[model samples]
Target: MDFFKFLYRSRSAFDYADDNPFGISTLLNAIIKRLQQRRKLTLLLAACLCLAAPCYAHAHIFSPLLEAILPRSSSEKPQASTAATDTVTSDTKITLPTDLSNPSTTTAPAVELELTKQPRPPLSEPSLYALLDAEFAANRGNTRRALVLYKQQSFKEDATAVFERALGFSLNNEDVHESLDFAKSWLDQNPDHVPAWFYVAHLALKAHDYTLAGETLNRILRYDPRADLSEILIGIYPENDDDQRELLAALQPIDSQQNASLSVLKAGLLNQFNDPQNALIHINRALLTQPDYVPFITLKADILRKIESTETVLSYVNQARLRNPDSKNLYLYEIRYLLDLKQSQQAWELLLKAQNRFNDDNEITLLAALVSLDVEQYRTADQLLNILVKSPAYLDQAYYYLGISAERQQRFEQAKYYLNAVVREDLVLAAREKVVSFELLNDNIEGAINTLQLLRQQYPVFAPDSYVMQADILWQHNEAEKALQLLTRVSRKYPDNELILFARAQLLDDSKDYLIKRTLLNHLQALDPSNLSYQLSYAQLLLANNRSSEQGLELAKNLIQIRYDDPRYDNELQLQALNLLASNALATENYAQVINYLQTPYDVLPTLRSGELLLRAYQGLGADEKVEALLADLQQRFSFGQRNVNDRVQLY
Candidate 1:
């Protein structure tokens, strides 16, 4: 202990001089004198020596950590600092020496060693403060400052700042790629940072970088495969031809063991690509995993509907309804399938049932009106539409249906009023038809023609019927040549239309030769072979044009035979056939056959043939009873019976 104290004497003397070196010796001598007077002269030296040992021992113990405070100029101010801005000093006082190799080296004899003190290059307070302020500002969620600082970094800590700043910016902004790039930098610095990995993977997904996203997701799975992020990874991963194959390969370990929702999503992807067969297989597998998945059931039903297996679709939808009875959308799906089958009445019944389950639902009500209209249940449709128009959700569609229902009932004025409120141009043609027909029915021929002319001006190429309508109006007004011109234009554009051919025949028959009329009639007849009207017109045309005596007779016979079982009577054809038979008999001078035909009779009233001509035909045949019977019938039918009697007598 004495030797150890002796070895540290030099450093102790140096510390004494540094603090109170010159005055300490004098104070010690005075203390010795005072002790001599108080205690005794003999003990004074021992007491001074004993105190000096402790002072030396204390100095030696602290020498390794505390360095000497070197004397400074009177004018220099002691540096003030905090942890963030602490300055390293040459004159170490109590701080631990950073360089442990030279622990004994001292700034002052009593203080710890200074291996080296390379004073940091002086930075202006404003500049140093700015650097720290920039760090705070970067951390303050300012992306621009953070990016600048990050780019300027050349150290680990600098990179750390950049990573943090990037994360902040990413969360603040919505650009997925920018967020991903920043997260990548952060991952480079802190590859094991879980939140950073999570965000990077998420951003990759949002950026639609499937390859990058998969890689990031794989990294996460490597660390935590069964983490909450597994679902997210599956959602964003590609499901294309090659990708699906790859995914199936990757998911082999978890094939039938995946969570219910993931399996459902996988099944949906298969359905989207039109592989419903495989999709159904996957969905069944998913249901075995979790039978109560409503979304899965809904998806199955939807896919069934897509393939037009309506019965199966209905079956699945019903099953889904049983499982989740409150599903409005499921009922809607059922209604749509029923409507597609033309089972509108059945669809309406389902809609009514749905209404009971979900009353006042605007969508269901709108669907109801549509089904009603489809089935031609106009009155029921009108009632539903009228109620729907009051709700904002269905006003437009309801109004359109209301107009259609009015049109069906021949309430043209009301129909037009409602139809005009419908803004869709697709409905314009139907609206124009109803409006024009209404005008024509009201005896407003010019108005009807003008409306059709307007339609032609608006959609010239599409509304070819306008030309035909204009021709008919013109012919009715006695402008035969103008009517022919319009009819010719329409016929040229729509040469195959039987209506155009028929209309042309009527126009020509009024003003042209029998041959020309017969040609138009035949054109109509050839296009529409089954129509009784066209057949009758063709027979009449043949008779007038002197086409062939046998041909005309055969046409009339064939028309009667073809139309014999037809429920609706071809009144015009039957009358024309009877008149033509009488005319043919008279032309051939077959008096017996003429009398036979005339006596057999055709109609109660001779709408085509004059009554006097009938009486003449009876007289010519010498059938006085038939003539007298016709007179009595005429007396009952006509007001001027006696006045109308023409006595010059030849029926044929």
Candidate 2:
């Protein structure tokens, strides 16, 4: 039903025609006209045959098109009648006949022939209406039939029945165009039908058609007059000056009666068109009208989520769930929010609660699979995603992640098989981009580069991540100048991108060419004012260039204070700062400062240089007793051989 609804309520390509229509009107109009013609013929044939055989018991000859469009059934003669609107049954069998005129060729026995020529069965074959009734009665959860029926008979006044069927179908199939068309037509014919137009407008906007969508919305306003279509039209029709005025005029007449849910939806649509700031404005405005609107809160949360405000998003989504605990979408969204915040334990706990709530829905299952994958529970993630892959909504994603899980488990052959299932261009390109990383890990340099080459061709404008990877590999292989040249070109091509700029600066610093080492590091620091690594590196470089007093000590102190828990914390940087400060104190012969610095132990480890540094520091302080004692301990720690015990020690 959602499929057909999607089709009808969907704006014709004419709405998007820059100079010409979107070019889909011909196909759609053709389907509509064909259905109309078939319907009229069905009526004429049924009426004529009934009148001609007045003496004979009559059965309706249903519209073949209508019957064909319904769920195929063997138990019923395909016919259009409201008498048998049962849920479609799986047992309903249908075999399309090559010859309609030759009735004997089909398994369906001739009704007249059986009535007059032989003993009649206890019951005549069920009419198409009866079959449809059985289908509706079976309640097999077939939503497609309702959508097809509406699309088949939309021209008739009796379309209300078809529309009802379509509405039922729409609950299960959100993408059904038939339900959208019927819903739109239903609203136009019955102005009081609010939900019909609501869904129709939603489908229209999603399909990117604003013209007829505006017309359908105008019909809604004619009844309620307070329905705000302005924001939606403004978002959908940015270039049209008149639409804004018309939308504004419509809103002014009945502004007090506007619904909060519709307004938030409009704002969300605006956000889709790169108007997030304005989107936030509209959503906030809706909140002013209905302060406790859960949908509006969720919409705002979604907006914040897109901007990477994980904490804010979690806060708002939690508020929404508190207000409306039954909202499946909010629960599912919160699970993702927990994952982004790295609260994986909390995420798993919420996932269990959601499963119990939704009765193990496929959408929730897929969401759980994603969270499991994130936390490295590959086997459990595989089991959940395998079931979801059967659905088209998540099929491609399932294949990609299944490939990842397989690779993690060292099932390389299985991983490749799963990866090969992703046929979507974007997914395939992303998979190809990953190929180099995996190949290089497996020690296949040529395979890695070849994979990267193919990826670069497909994603020529994808910001050249492969170039950085390749340059790093080259640097490790000792092709220093070539590595530098590659990074330089990449930086030149994408100057505004911080990653390339940072990489280029690091490469130059590593080149050991002092002439421009400070200059390059300075440029990188300026480009990214808050880059802790570059700030610290610049300090180290300054000290190495004999500029410790000029700025090195102050810069190093600032770097450590700013990034107390930064991931790039290096003991060497801290030691350099301390060593420089201590050397300055000794230069002035400040014995107290020297003693204070020496008291803070050097970070000695599995290194002879650190031991030697410790030995030198003790001797400089003239603490002979402490020095002799430390050297004895060091000799025992790294002893060459056993010797006679003596109070004397030698330093060569």
Best-performing candidate as measured by TM-score: 1
* Per-candidate count of clashing residue pairs (backbone under 3 Å): 10, 29
Ten consecutive residues with minimal summed lDDT in candidate 2? 94-103
Segments in model 1 whose C-alpha atoms lie over 4 Å from true places: 1-179, 195-198, 206-208, 218-256, 274-278, 284-293, 302-313, 423-652
Residue 503, candidate 1: Cα error in Å is 22
List TM-scores for all candidates, in order. Answer: 0.43, 0.39
Candidate 1 clash figure, as a count: 10
- Write candidate 1's Cα lDDT for 47-166 as tens digits: 334434545534432221111111111235434222213221212111211221112222211112111232222322222122333333433344455444333331123133234433
Structure candidate 1, residue pairs in collision: 17-21, 66-112, 67-112, 105-113, 616-650, 616-651, 617-650, 617-651, 617-652, 618-651
Report the C-alpha displacement of residue 385, candidate 2, in angstroms.
2.8
Off by over 4 Å in 2: 1-326, 333-363, 374-377, 387-396, 413-434, 488-498, 509-512, 547-549, 563-652
